[model samples]
Target: MVEIKFNGQRYAYWQQVHISASVDDLAASVTLAVTRPGTGQRLGVDANTVIEVLIEGTVVTTIRPDSIRRHVDANSHSIDIEARSLGRELIDCQYSQTLSGLSLDEIVKRLCSTFNVPVQVTAKAAVVPDFSLQCESPANALINAARAANLLLYATPDGGLLLTEPSSAAPVATLVYGEHIESYTVVDEYKLRYSDYLVKGYDYRNDLALKGAVKDSGITFFRPLHIMADKTGQGVGGCDRRATTERNRRQARANRIDLEVVGWTHAGGVWDINSQVRVIIPDEDIDGVYLIGDRAFTLDDQRGSMTRLSVMKREAFLGDPAPGKAKRGAKHKAKSQDERLIYATDLE
Candidate 1:
């Protein structure tokens, strides 16, 4: 009853994981990926392992040593697996398996009766997930068809899947799939533009450049600086998951990253930056924080339109007003030398 599969852990979607197991007298460890349902994530799992088998809802049986299907694609072409024997070949069907509330014969007959599809019946024990169990019995016709020939059920991270035997110890009749993903990935993403709220197209870039420059300035800023989302020209929550470029861009401060429920968007100018994102990688120097490996590039929402979202880079933080400086533009009216220089130059 001892096992080892990614240490017996599950991942969501597709994860490239390593799993090994020793059940009964069989021992195996190989590399294979866990794949998502449809074009599912490719998680790494070893097909060579002889996982212990659980009947009904209990891990009462040990899979015999040869009860596994293992193969490699031919040197160049493909090698289809011929139905080989697993464990001891059932010369006479040692154990009679009856699917209560379900009959493969009836299901196949009904499918042929209704859809004209003669589903080839391969009577076998469970192997892979296939349908949404919570779906009503009325859906059995279309539902069973979606099932894997072996009938292994997979669940979403959020939604739980029920097992045929809800009481088994080993992964019972169901497997819960979620963030425990075999591996993390960034498939696709959209950068929601807040152009409707933009002050000006180019102005946005200018402001961003300035802010970026200020942020990039190497001076040691105090720890835990709380900057409001206002005046920054940055829409709250708009900055969190956008595809980012390799060039330095300040990460939203722990205190500054906003997750506002409601925000603004561009009527037409949207941006989508497709990129690769790794789950998380730790900074050797930093203990708990991780530097994300999210490769990114800028893309226009309005691919054909002339409009584009503005991105600006700024240098030197604009902070702390001059202590005794006169109000801007006061030189001609009434002021001092400093006032003339400060207010008169770059009036815009």
Candidate 2:
């Protein structure tokens, strides 16, 4: 069940509502359709009206209408409302500053306070000195700072912000393909693969000279792809760390196989973005742990309720050496076998 509240009144006359939330740097949004008020009716609302969305008795989001449309015909009249989470305010609020010797958590907290947005930081990141940035908005600054620390910042269901390390929590539930999954689709992309990473930084002590390459290796084939990265403001150790982190990220994304599944269980209330989940699929020979990267919650009187999940490998969330390898042995073997067969045939 869904409820919309406006002007100190609760409304349950909505025909349908859809809520989408994701961990992939997207703002949670709500779309609802309600019966239009009749002539001389006291109910009044507009695009600027602040509203709250309640799902199954829990306050899911606080938003203001981004757009409102009215549908009128001989048969009926209805109003469609679209709203975005309060986090959108951060994006709209521009900021400019330079701070030295502040950690990622401190920066996020300060920014959130400035914008009057509540924040919760689950994990702390390494502190850096002499950080400087100029962004058009506070959101952009926070995002870039989080990226440097390998963290993620997103809006929570209750209109608060969350800054945390992905895949740091344990799985809340296990999903079996034949049991809870109603339908699913898988996508595997590997066209952009790299085996070596070269990260260059500046040596401040040596009169701002460009530092040498910091290399890291990963699994690859076909001409040993090389990737270059600039860590201009970072130190030598920071550059090395950045190279390793980027290499792990690239390798994980290159060999990534994502799954989109519609399941029977109610995952919205139980799981959030970056939540770990154990998945088993016998037919696809897949049995591993994954992270919930994206999710959509839907409920209707006729169709019942369902949750759609975008599951990605742990590497996508935790980078590398944390969850180790995902289920890619079979696919790798098949590709290698095909290559060997082609070479043998040519020789014969």
Residue 232 lDDT (model 1): 13
Instruction: Give the Å shift of residue 119 in candidate 1.
Output: 36
Query: Runs in model 1 with CA error above 4 Å?
Result: 1-215, 219-348
Candidate 2 lDDT tens digits, 26-98: 2588888766544323337775677778866777777877887777766667777788887777776555566
TM-score of 2: 0.74
Q: What are the lDDT scores of the predictions, listed in order? A: 0.20, 0.59
Q: Lowest summed-lDDT stretch of 10 residues in model 1?
A: 339-348
Top model by TM-score, which number?
A: 2
Assess the local accuracy of residue 190 in candidate 1 as a C-alpha lDDT between 0 and 100.
Answer: 17
lDDT of 1 by residue, 1-348 (tens): 112223365223212222222111111122222222232222233444323322122232222232223333333221111111122221112221212234433433342334222233323322211111221221222222222121212121111111121111221011011321122222211121111111110112222211111222232343222211111112211111011110122222111111111111122211111111122212212112212111111112222111111111111011111111111211133234422211000000
* Prediction 1 TM-score vs. true: 0.15
Highest-scoring model, lDDT: 2
How high is the lDDT of residue 102 in model 2? 72
